[model samples]
Target: MRLSLEQIIRYQTEGYLIVENVCSHAELQPVIEEIASEIDKRADRLFAEGKLAELYKDEPFERRYSLLHRQCPEIGRGFDIAGYLGDEIFKLLCNKNLIDLVECLLGSEISCNPIQHLRAKHPARGSADGSSAPDYFQNVPWHQDCAVTSEDSEASEIITFWMPLVDATAETGCMEVMPHVFKLGYLNHQAEGGTMIVPEKLPQVEPVLAECPKGSLVIMNKYTPHRGISNRSDIIRWSIDLRYHKTGANSGRSFQPSFPVRSSSDTGSVLRDPDVWRTLWREAANGAGRKIHRV
Candidate 1:
């Protein structure tokens, strides 16, 4: 709960900053109902042990690895959910008031890029958006999330902590930054590798509707050009990004080595790292927690 120098000069001139609540729905509802009931009981026991196609078929790894849950450990999944929501989602993702509002807006000393969690914009309803029957899948085009993968990192001094577990107004689909546009660092768009949405590329940045509320928190900067528009209503946008790093900067990506089960209750024996122990055994078999109780 820190950050305040005019919110670090509006996160360095609108790279992004829309912090509001912080957290308190009884401290984020029992770890989000215990991680969404452990991801709906592993999607119904991997659809009844069919192995849910090992998550998008045979997985050779790369085809955006079938959207690695929205493309790789960006909190997309793989255990370590901030070590299991320990710290109320890590004080709102290392919230020293957003690390002094990202060290006075990228002046120095940031560090928060192991990539946090929460990002469920679901609602694609019965495929083929064939009008009616709970039509979902709203807007999320206009690409620019460090070019999807890692593209090498240092993507012009990263910064994108768009937190929103509720009240993101503008009809459920909030998130439209372009303000000041990260002083024009990286933006030539044409995504395909991981797929978020690109639509060719033209929006010189204009939308800024983040109306926030439920534990609010938004601060863009991965080249200051955002996206995420859909929810149209009926509600269901839930966000919780949290990606910072200036103190030397380069936390671009690193934290995939899990494998050290040993918590008979003493909760110790930490080792995890074999690709985050096989993505925490595939997010605990698609659940995200529970079962790995090594006590």
Candidate 2:
């Protein structure tokens, strides 16, 4: 998964790499099924209890939307992705084809969070004029994840993995990135959710739409200025974003990376050693047990 020589240069220069089809539909089928099944099970249980609608009766749309998973299957706030998505989710998150690319760009000794999150959009009524109504596109505007956290400058040594479960297109609202923006260094994002490029510091390049097919993985430095597209299409746009930090780099957790990355995948570790990676990969195949069918 180590990046190609060109990929490294491109990343250093453009601040992002759009690796197409990092995972195939076949590769992602199991996890997609698992996620959909989880959604159905939770929805069913809540409906049966006659408390689903009442749960958000008093909340605003924004808060209600954000808290949907909370009232169902815990989302974020001490979220352990490995426990939920199971090992394959972690493998997909740490797959060498992509991790190698990340290590090449960010260096070795990586520590990744096991929290895998899904963002989906469904059809709703009377949406904003230009906003994609109903379907929830994962795009959260152009802002760095670090900007929202209390972690200081040193936490910039991180990369993000955005894996889409469906084809990400312009119409469907894929990612839009300002190439080489990171080379200008991290820009200060305004408090009102707007980010601007440093004036004349970096040459301007037209934003590129990251139209990737289902299972494609995009890896980029955390400081890269990027944002999600609004899903104008009726179909749901689903994706999972996984973040990783270098072992010694500041992770915003008191300036120290949290949790040791098992150098091997045997115990669900995502270490950088090649031999360990192979061993763990094989273990994944044998231990996958039965494929979890999608709902």
Candidate 3:
């Protein structure tokens, strides 16, 4: 599953590349099933606590959360179970096909950054004032991934892989990126709308929509300016964003843990125990209150 020369060239020239069918539905079934189970568990708990009237057991995975939110707006506040890296998620992170493509661009040595996250962008609820409710996670503003980290990792070449668990269409808030903006280097970013590029610094180039189907991968350079669109559809737009860089590179957020997924030079360093990955996340969560390096 290494990228073709044409694909490599396009990535280098355009700052991003869309690799279709990188992983099949069967390959992603584990994570998808795990997520659905988690949602069911949450729904059950909410129902027991009287926050929800019905379990909505018959609803599909994409619509379950949205329907739950409609029943109880507060349901959206605590449904984020992505912080924990379960066995399924760990397996997906080290998927052979995915790492092969990563090795093509980042050499044989690879380290999975701790900045990964699984996003369940629910539909925006319209307010009585004729405006959509504020959706901090779904409607991301334009910003480079590099700008979200500390200056110490500016030299690291981190490649972000955005994979959708469901079809990411224009209506469902697919990613939008400014073409070739990686060549411009890091742009001045502010805290406005999720550490976005300053409006004055935005390039004149038109943004390109990264409409991806389920199991497709959208790879982007760390310096590329991109943002998630506002999900207006009825179903939740489920996706996962993972980051990888060369082994031993400064992971801008050094306070968090990173694990080596593959090492050609020193195979012993490659993480073989899923428990180690789980423990690392647990420790990070326990110490989350400490001072963390912010962009």
Q: Rate the local accuracy (lDDT) of all candidates.
A: 0.53, 0.57, 0.83
Better of 1 and 3 by lDDT: 3
lDDT value for model 1: 0.53
lDDT (Cα, tens digit) per residue for candidate 2, span 21-138: 6777787887666665554455556767864553444543223333455354332222234324454564566566666655676565666642236666532333332333423334
- lDDT per residue for candidate 1 within 168-269, as digits (tens), equals 877666877678856766666653432443455445555677677876678777766666666554434666776665544344443322222222333345
Q: Model 2's lDDT to the true fold?
A: 0.57
| Candidate number of the best lDDT | 3
Cα TM-score of candidate 2: 0.67
Which runs in model 1 stand beyond 4 Å of their true positions? 1-11, 16-41, 44-46, 49-80, 83-108, 113-115, 124-174, 178-227, 231-240, 245-295
- Evaluate candidate 1 by giving its C-alpha RMSD to the native, one decimal: 17.7
TM-score of each: 0.28, 0.67, 0.92
Among the numbered candidates, top TM-score falls to: 3
In model 3, the runs with Cα more than 4 Å from the true position are 73-82, 125-133, 285-287, 290-295
Alpha carbon lDDT at 127, candidate 2: 34
